[model samples]
Target chain A: MIELSDVHKSFGSKDVLRGVNLTLPKGESMVIIGGSGTGKSVLLKCVLGLIQPDTGSIAVDGQDVTRLRQGSSERDAFLARFGMLFQGGALFDSLPVWQNVAFRLLRGSLKRPKSEAREVAIEKLRRVGLTPDVADLFPAELSGGMQKRVGLARAIAAEPEIIFFDEPTTGLDPIMSGVINELIREIVVEMGATAMTITHDMSSVRAIADDVAMLHGGVIQWSGPVKDMDASGDPYVTQFISGSADGPIETVR
Target chain B: MSFLATIGRTVLGFLAAIGSVTLFAMETVSHLFRPPYYPREFGHALLQIGYFSLPVVGLTTIFTGGALALQIYAGGARFSAEAVVPQIVAIGMVRELGPVLVGLMIAARVTSSIAAEIATMKVTEQIDALTTLSTNPMKYLTLPRVLAATLVMPVLVGVGDVIGIMGGYLVGVERLGFNASTYLRNTVDFLEFLDIVTSLAKGAVFGFLAALMGCYFGMRSGRGAQGVGRATKGAVVAASVLILAANFILTELFFAA
Candidate 1:
């Protein structure tokens, strides 16, 4: 299980996340929805230790993560258990698709000969609906949708127990987004991985999420199963999902 | 505007910058010799730092050598000693032009390229992606470039010295009406091996300095396009200044006595 309690974070004088609390049960998919400038990404970064909260407790499996000291072998072991798909595909431009997919496996203790790793990479690519021949192409040559699929392949290549997706369907065409959403749903359910995704696409919520949370006023305004998401009744969740700009989510500028 | 205060501020800033760079350089050297060495990346750096650099460094050396020959011949004509052309050309190319020209060439070519490339990577989240994959950016990117340049530059300078001297030799023998044997003999007799050693060593030092400055500034560059541009400019200026400053200090250390 992943749990965040009273997380507070600010950038200089601007408060981005204020006393936000949330929990995702094991082997379930939780999606957080918010406006563009809302703290959804910041919350994810905080969980990944990319950013530190001012005062909060973020625990994975009940271990306090907000204050976890890093770089120890034990800490590295913990870090290795989680996989993430960045907003941008973020594949290494220098490497071909297969190499990018096998990046983690080709480093550290998991490293093997190039042929062995490439075979594993190709299998993972096939799982994400990419041809083995496409593995030789660089990231720059691939279209946006292809890159996103390659990124997903890389994320699940090592098959971590926990995974996080940031804007998984952004920049994708409707059909491609639906395909990616279905793939994400299938992967998480088949692997029984605890998953957290941050996005505004309600279609993604319906396709992949089991539970959903709404972030507003630097806090989680409401959360429930995807079945109850439409009737959340919280004005913020309603306005946000309905794509209304004339809501409580005001622009300070 | 007190002189001591001004001097103190400059010294303090310089020290801080050097201290930070020293720590980073140490980290780079450690990572270079450590396992998980990226041979593929090193080959790419070799292509970028050495192979692509040859034309620019060669062209600069040839033109500078020809121009130096003309200037020296003209000045020596006033003393009826224009025949000293070949000797001075040989020494100039071996002792100074080879090292300084190569240094400046790398500062302009390699430094800016590395800085711009790394800054782009930083802005586009590639470096962060490397970290997420558990690859150290310095180990993967910076060390290979620095190491390749450090190893390749001396050979480049040695080749440039021969080419620049050929430019001078051709000009002196054909245009200045000097006997081929006399000019060749003078060049051979006047140049010392230490001159060659000093220049080559300086070339290696300068190459390392240029690439180091590029990677350092690029990594430290602020976010956004404007930040990347500023970092690229800063890397070029810093690399150029450091190369010239190191040249003078090395000259003093090698021959001041």
Candidate 2:
């Protein structure tokens, strides 16, 4: 289980996250939806310990992750159990696809033999619908959708206990988006991993989210199951669901 | 009062920058002796920073050497002391010109490349990815380049010194009507061990500052293309200025009696 309590973050007086409180049960798929610049990404980063909150507690499995010292052995061990798919895929351009996928297996405490690591990379690539031949190419050569798949493959390669996907369906065509959403749903269910995904794409939310959390004004405005999202009578949720521009929630801000 | 306020702000910003850079340097050096060293990355950095930089360093030093010889010959002619060309060229190349010129060339070539590459990586979030993968960016990225440049710089300076002296020899024997054997002998005999050692030491220090500046600016770069452009420009400028400044200090320490 992951829990965030009263999380607040500000950048030079511009509050990005304000007193955000949310929770995800173990092995649950929680999707955070919000408008652009509403701190959806910041909420995810706070949980991942990538961004430190101003005054809050982030507990993963009842352990306060935010308080862990940077570069500590405990922090490293905690990070090792997480798989993150960054918004841009964040593939190391200089390395080949296989090496990037097998990066965790190749170095540090999780070191594996080169041959074994390569084999695992190929297997993971196949799991994401990539051919063995694609393993040799660089990230620059792949299309945006393909890069996202590679990023997904790399994320699950370590068989992490938790996975965080940041805007996974962004910048893809509708067909590709559907494909990725289905892939994520299938993978999360099969792996039984605790997953947190941030996306505004309703299709992705319906396909992957067990619970949907609407982030607005730096706080979770509504939280419930995907089925309840449509009928949630809160004006903000209603306005968001209907894609209405004029409502209690000001679109201009 | 407004002008004074602006001046104060500028002075404070400069000091803050120095402080941040100093802390970053300390962090990088601290990680240097720790475990989980990436020898493969270090080797690649060596090939990139040291071997690949030979052409530029060589070209600059050689031309400087040749020009130094010509100037020394012409100047010495005014006093009928033309024979001092070989000794002056040898001493100049071995003691100061060789290392300083090579250092600046590296600042231009290696520092800018390192900064641009790292800044792009930061912009693309690859550095963050590395951190998430249980890797330290300082160790994986900065240490390799810094160590490689530091270790390889003396070798580069040694090579540059020889090439520069050879350039002076070419100019002296061919253009200045000096005997080739006598020029070579004077050049060889005039250079002292202290001069060579000081040159190599300067090379090491200059290389460290150059690569450190690159990593510092690159890691601190802000978001987007503009951030990357600023990082690259800042790195080259900082590296060049630091190299020149360090050269003066090192020269004073070495030669001031």
Candidate 3:
């Protein structure tokens, strides 16, 4: 389980996260939805310890993540249990597809032999719908959808207990987005990993989310299960779901 | 008062930048002693920074040495002491031209390339990916390049010094009516061990500055194409200027009367 309490972050004088409080139980998929620049990414990064919050507490599995030092053994052990798929694939351009997938296994605490790592990478690639031939190719050689799949493969290769997906379906076409959403849903279920995904794609929310959280003005405007999202009777949730420019949420930054 | 405030702001910014770079260099050096060293990355950096840099370093030094010989001959002739060509060329090449020229060449070639490559990596989020994978960017990226450049620069300088003296030798014997054996003898006889040592030391310093500036600018770069462009330009300029400034300081320390 993951928990956040009164999380606040500010950049200079501009406050990004005013006060965020949320929780995700184990083996659940929670999707966060908001307009552009609503600090959806910042909220996720805060949980990952990529961005430090000004105030608040984040705990994963009863361990206070805020107290863990960067580059510490404890922090490393903590990070080992979690995986993240970036908004952009963020694949290493210099390494081949297999190496990128097997990166965690090839180095650090999860060190494995070269041949074994390669085999594991190939297997993960297959799981993500990539062929064995694709292993030898570079990230640049793959299409955006293929790269996303590769990123997904890399995120799951370690079999991390928790996974975070940041705007996973942003740049893909509708068909590809559907495929990715289905893959994410299946992977989360099969792995039984606690997953937190942030995206504005309603199709993705319906396809992948077990629970939906609406983030607006750096706070959760509404929180409920996927089925209750439409009938939640919250104006903010209604405006966001209907994709209306005219609503309680301002369109302009 | 407003003018004074603006000047103060600029001065503070300058000092802050220096402090930041110093911290970065210290962190990079600290990683040198840590575990999980990447030997393959270090070897690749050696090839990229040292081996690939040879042709440009060689071509530049040869032409500069040839030009130095001509200038020294013309100046020595006006003093009715044209026989001093071999001695002056040897001293000039070994003490100043060889190291300085090689340093500037590296700033132009290796510095820009490192800055551009690392900056692009930053923009593309590869650095973050490395961090998530438990690989420190300082260890995997900066240390290998910096260490490779620092170690190989002395060798490059030695090679440049020899080639440059040969350039002078060719010009002296063929174009200026001097005997080949005599010019070569004069060149070898005039150069002291101290001059060569100082030259190599300067090469190491210059090389350190070159790679350090590249990594520093690259890691701090902003987002996108404009950011990468600015980082590359800033790195080359900073490396080149630091090399020249360090040359002056090292020269005054080594050869001061």
Clash count per candidate: 0, 0, 0
User: Against the true structure, what is each candidate's TM-score?
Assistant: 0.90, 0.98, 0.97
lDDT of 3 by residue, A1-253 (tens): 9999999999998888989999999999999999988999999988878789999999998888988887788888888888889888999988999999999999889999999999999999999899999999999999999999999999999999999999999999999999999999999999999999999999999999999999998888899999999999999999999999888888778
- Full candidate order by lDDT, most accurate first: 2, 3, 1
Candidate 1 segments whose C-alpha is farther than 4 A from its true place: A5-11, A52-57, A62-72, B1-19
* C-alpha-based local distance difference test score of model 1: 0.88
lDDT tens digits, residues B1-257, model 1?
Answer: 69999999999999999999899889888886667688888999999899988898788888777877888899999999898898899898988888988998898899998998898888777786676565668888999999998988998898899889878877877887778898889989999989989989999999999999999988888888998999999999999999999999999999988
i-RMSD of all predictions: 1.9, 0.8, 1.3
- Summing lDDT over every window of 10 consecutive residues in candidate 2 chain B, give the lowest-scoring window: B31-40
What 10-residue stretch in candidate 3 chain B is worst by lDDT?
A: B127-136
TM-scores computed on chain B for all candidates: 0.94, 0.98, 0.98
lDDT of 1 by residue, A1-253 (tens): 9999999999999999999999999999999998787889899989877678999899999888767664345545666787788888888887899999999888875678889989999999999999999999999999999998998998888888898899999999999999999999999999999999999999999999999998887999999999998888888888878888687777553
Q: List the RMSD of every prediction in angstroms.
A: 3.1, 1.0, 1.3
By DockQ thresholds, what CAPRI class is model 3?
medium
Q: Residue by residue across A8-104, what tens digits does model 2's lDDT show?
A: 9998889999898999999999999989999998888787777889998999999999999878899999999999999999999989999999999
